[model samples]
Target: MSAGDDGLVPDLGRGALTDRVRATVLGRRTPRAWFLALGLATLVSLLFLLGVVYVLSVGVGAFGLNIPVAWGFPIINTIWWIGIAHAGTLISAVLWLTRQDWRASISRSAEAMAMFAIVLAGSYPLLHLGRPWLAYYLLPYPNLMDLWPQWRSPLVWDFFAIASYLLFTASFLYLSLLPDLASLRDGARRRFQQLFYGVLALGWRNSARHWARYEQAHRVLAVIAAPIVVSVTGTISLDLAVSIVPGFHFTIFPPYFVAGALYSGFATVAIIAIILRGLFGFRDLITRAHLNRLGIMMLCFVLVVDYAYLQEIFTAFYTGEAFYRGVYFDRWTGPYAPYYWGMILCNVVLAQGLWFRRLRESVPGLLSLAVIADIGMWLERFQIVITSTHKDYMPSAWDTVRPTAWDWLTYAGSIGVFFVLLLLFIRLMPSVSMHDMRALLHRRREGGHG
Candidate 1:
């Protein structure tokens, strides 16, 4: 069997795969679509600047941080972006460990997405703090005022959790890019391009010793990253679980949050993979088989999420706690009923399309559903935060909350930043893992394309 037989990388060989990926970064002229998307993202990203300026000058009062619902769009967007980041790291680390060949085609881009998404996610926590300059207070620093982060606070937990994930993600992304950077350094036609890539590559000779050491370092990094998939979000879940509120207090939050994060993260990876595959003419590399496998992975998570939902409802009733029962009731029929139902349909009901071979194989169908699932995930976060916080144990604390224009602007701006980072990544590096693809080619020659 050849590479093309199993519908992976068709007509694969070292020279062809290297040339195809290198051209994306080293080419003189970039695609028009890249320019248009970057321009739009840049424009929208300015909204972040405007919102920050207003908040800094006018204080956090410029936005809609009301009494009952203090955590609004900013918190919601933060959680959503963090979940997206997890998907990339999870895919790259787990798939590589399990020896999945399809991961070779998408792992580079996925890791890049994780890094950029986490960077964007980091911005919200500070921005949500009205006095953004005082953000360093979250850190455990020795000070004359004797102020330190409360050891038991979930906010403090979140700070360390995000910091840890970001560090690992950056290391993982850099390790994966070393070989490709070396490729760019050698293949560059311009003097500046050679210098740039050379500095990034750190003088790689591609010797046997280099390959052996690189593989060892890569494995160690993967080992360190594997546990983060469970730990980071589990820490985030603590932010809600420790609270005395009805909907927020639940034992299932840790696993539920992790399952939802991976579910949404995989959908995001699919959407980006589909776009990049189409734009760069990487049809053979990111084949239907890859998409099929991704769909099945998402289906497994969908069943897990459904079970989580059932557990939440059952536990609420079985425990017979009015606060928990009332919160769930409001979640189903409260002011945000549309968001609740929309989340269910998009994530649970509509995702049923993945069960069919024809729909899963259809690029357009999966793309549309992936996008919907992404939105559904965001809604899930929104419902979880708002329903629990909006109406507390006391009736007097109940208040309706809505995001103001500034809130929306900040949210939109974070999205802009995410896309700008993603677009730059697409333009500056090989979106596919080259060395991994070479291994795939070798395996295919030995009749192991399956």
Candidate 2:
């Protein structure tokens, strides 16, 4: 079947398609559901802020950290958020480079998701620092005292990785938005609206020169973004792998983490795509085909994750090292055994549902699987961070570390922060890319699949 036959972009005039997207931001009336969701998200974000204040005031002791298990929700959530962020780059940059038409409808939101998820991911390291104000110590700058950041510290590596990715994502997102922002600038009636978009549009004139330069710049950024996507997660994985902890010290971690990150990321994109379609009524633009493609992507990466899981176990046993074998045994029968099995069930077993074409194309089925995949990925991080550290070499030092109320609050609040930002973003800006959709329509008219 041809791409148009699958309804990537429904048969609509350029003006009609543009109007449908513009109306989401420029419409006279707003959706009640958006307001409700925003209000709830804002409340939770406030709670997240409150949690931050509590942590700053009371110290990182507010989290569930102990002797061996110094890493807690902050580290787990950081890795989880970073993994979630990967899909945005993959969808927006990698797929764009590969000339995937389906990415047009979703890339804008995916980029936005990447932007926010990285911010949240970057915030955790600061929160984990006992004295977050001293975070600048990680930055390599000449100071009066001539103090330099430890060059070998993984924490230093994380700072640079997150910072670099954040800059790249922001640039990538804004660059892609130039054409769409120009559209909003032209379509907006109010002076304030025009000025707001005009500044962001960066003087885009829709001229041939502007289009050529924009495409060149965007393609360059996409090329940079492809490697950034892999390296960011790989660096984060190194933060664990560099450690001698039995669960963390694996040569397979870099690729395993990369696959897991993309798996969670695509799952998040699926969730966001479903939410966007339902909230903004983009059912025709974002069709069952989009969901099916997302399902396929999720399945492909998750199978890699399932293989990595087995490889980890095999490596643990093959080494003939008591520590490595004991770690897996503990994972199976220790206090955190349930979490280990839960991750297995969600990621390895339940994820197999995507093999069925019926399930891949079912809205409810895809959404459920996506949510489960995210949960499983989170559980995977949870086990890697906590279970790995909780049981160290010294039997006397081995103790269970449970998340305190503050940990739950902070984790849930971070989620709230992400949704609140996303909700506000959709309300203010075009959630779908008007220009990209227009191009898709143009391709359909020319009887060529883009």
Candidate 3:
């Protein structure tokens, strides 16, 4: 973990570190690159807003939902987003608990990604609900009507899981921002700037007692967040695992889902880190060392996911369950065969390149792998969700799951939502956690890893 010749963060003192972080937010003029990116994101977001309006006006008929394949792109997008969100908590909370100093460089962006992705994921539940206005009925508050939510349902589980995760992620992001906000307020050049960040800082005096409380709270939150990351995905998998459908009924789902989640989540974090490193000039902060570590993590999860794939196939063959066996065969040989093989190539075959130190450290190599893995993860979700439901136990009821224009539009637009939120986050505040980076610098000065 030593910095060696390639440190994760630039060896800067307190003043330089503060200036480096503060300049990202408080710069008098916006960069042309930022303006262009924001314009594109805003345009896509506007289209997304239009798509939502269309969906609301036209109803669920706008999507492609047939008899056997009721769930379409919405479910796929929901699960994909959820998987992406999982990496944030794992990187932020789990790494902090394990004392990985490299995390300090990327945790803020990762956590912000998770929080934004959660909102995107959460929207699917409402959007997919035919009567979206009646979504409040999912909540189990006392009412005059005797009707209540079915506690045993997976949908209900999803509601609580997503809700709980949102609360935890929001609190974690806000609490961690307090110290930075206080610094920004103190260094404000204008009265408006001081007032703006001052209110957001929540009046932190940074006393010894306050620092002690912050540390205690952060530790507890990290502990709480670790389980939430594991449990939320497990609960989401229950939606499929509990089903009696052939591919859906497998016992390997929970672990597989979690592995898949981390797999794609790490890829997404890498994508964001790499893009922002260039766009925001964080080459020193988000260094190649950090990218290499991320690549290694992605490779580790690739092995886990590959093992789970083998297990799913092996279990089917061992159990001699014709339904499960057929599902596995159909996955690689059926109409979705291309997707399955593409997933294998992208996730398993191509990902093996990371075993080499050179490739892991290469910018284009890491970026290519990250993008390919993200596509593969989406395909993984598509195969798992669609293949299972499109052809169930009854052969007569089998049908193809095709997405309409609206389905494609809405899904693409959700990506817009993620970018818009992320771009705004980077623009408005110190995207990098200044306090944590300072700590990292301190650690390195003390002859430790950062």
Candidate 4:
């Protein structure tokens, strides 16, 4: 193998690679760790369900919302989850289109992460709707009374953005899965397993014609997904950017949010890669080099985020607008100042560690940084949502909005929901892209790296 190929994959035959990945799903004995993790995730998901029921029975008033700070955990979580979803598309679609061989092993898991994250993202808006049952009102379906959605409302925009992104993500994931599902169907000894995979495979036979069509479809989707990736987050950012709110009305928000989203997204992919590697003993497939690449990407985006932070502050003072200047002042010295500083610490200070090669390649280092990056991104969203509106233009209306227990409960529960869905996804499907890995191996062999 060439030196450049080091830490991509281990020396293994095609059959060995296929067997290792397939065994994660098809093996008879479930791992004890998997059981434990699933149990914990399920418990948390139940908690989330309980929170949802309580909110529905009572109201969104169960949260820490006030007249000024009407947007609370719901909006914060929606933006955070949506941001996390970006990495999956970036990894699976952008990397594939670019022919980055390192993406082969991690792309499937990344896509799954994106899929679940977007689902969680989309759910928050419905929860935030005091009457979730009325969520359909956000849609533009014709009615007998001739009522229609307010096209100008951010809620309607979110509805379309999230729904479109979710559909695109699902199609991308299912399209990518067809070949692997066919492999699972062919390899399954049990009739039930065969039937399950066969139905999902959509009758994929791995013929040359099938491959040709698959390539064409996948490339087309990839081309479409790249723009969707930027547009979705930018649209979400416009929810704040289009507003008259001092801190929220920055022109830089679209690009700022995009960078922050990709930053957090790559960090999440890294965390998932590390967990998958540790749990499945995929040291050879998801190697240190992959972590290094992830860290580099994270570093790249966080740098952009840091620059945005500076630009935001500069734009505030440059305009010489008291409201904008006060927003920056409040962010630095207000009640939520701690969160703003913590975001700076995590996204700016600690993120600089990625510039060091040793730290980026170290499992513990990369994992710690990834977790920190996600937390930092959350803090960024938290401060942006809460601090912006908590003390608006009017001193008379300025009030503090502290999160109620229900707020924490709902937020934590959402995290649980995401994990539960992701765990089940990995257990049922191939965590790694089998066909992509095979193609990688084939290319490596042709290049004398096998």
What Cα-based lDDT does every candidate model obtain? Answer: 0.86, 0.91, 0.88, 0.91
Q: Model 2 Cα RMSD, Å? A: 1.4
For candidate 2, the lDDT comes to 0.91
Off by over 4 Å in 2: 1-3, 447-450
Model 3: lDDT equals 0.88
Work out the TM-score per prediction: 0.96, 0.98, 0.97, 0.97
Put down candidate 3 lDDT per residue, 180-250, tens digits, no spaces.
99989988888899999999998998788888899899999999988898899899999999989988888
Q: Against the correct fold, how does model 4 do in TM-score?
A: 0.97
Please give the lDDT score at residue 55 for candidate 4: 93
Model 3 misplacement above 4 A: 1-6, 447-450
Worst lDDT run of 10 residues, candidate 4, spans: 1-10
Clashes in model 4: which pairs?
Answer: none
Q: How would you order the candidates by lDDT, starting with the best?
A: 4, 2, 3, 1
lDDT of 1 by residue, 1-450 (tens): 544666766576788889889999999878888899899999999998899888889877777778788888778888888888887987888778888777889899889989988888888888888787888898888999988789889989999999999999999999889988999898998999999999999998888899889989989887777889888888988998998888889999999998888888888889888978877888888988888877887888877887998999999899998888888899999998999999999888998888987877889988987888789889999998888899888889899887789988988887888889899998898898887788778787766642
Candidate 4, 1-450: lDDT as tens digits: 552357786677778999999999998876788889889989988878998999999999999998899998999999999999999999999998898889999999999999999999998889998998988887788899799888888767878999999999999999999999999998999999999999999899999999999999999999998999899999999999888888999999989999999999999999989989887888989989999999999999999999999899999999999988998889999888999999999999999999999999999999999999999999999999998898778989999988999989888998889889888998899999999898888778656431
Task: Give the lDDT of residue 173 in candidate 4.
Answer: 98
- After superposition, the stretches of candidate 4 with alpha carbons farther than 4 Å from their true spots are 1-4, 447-450
User: Which 10 residues in a row give candidate 3 its minimum summed lDDT?
Assistant: 1-10
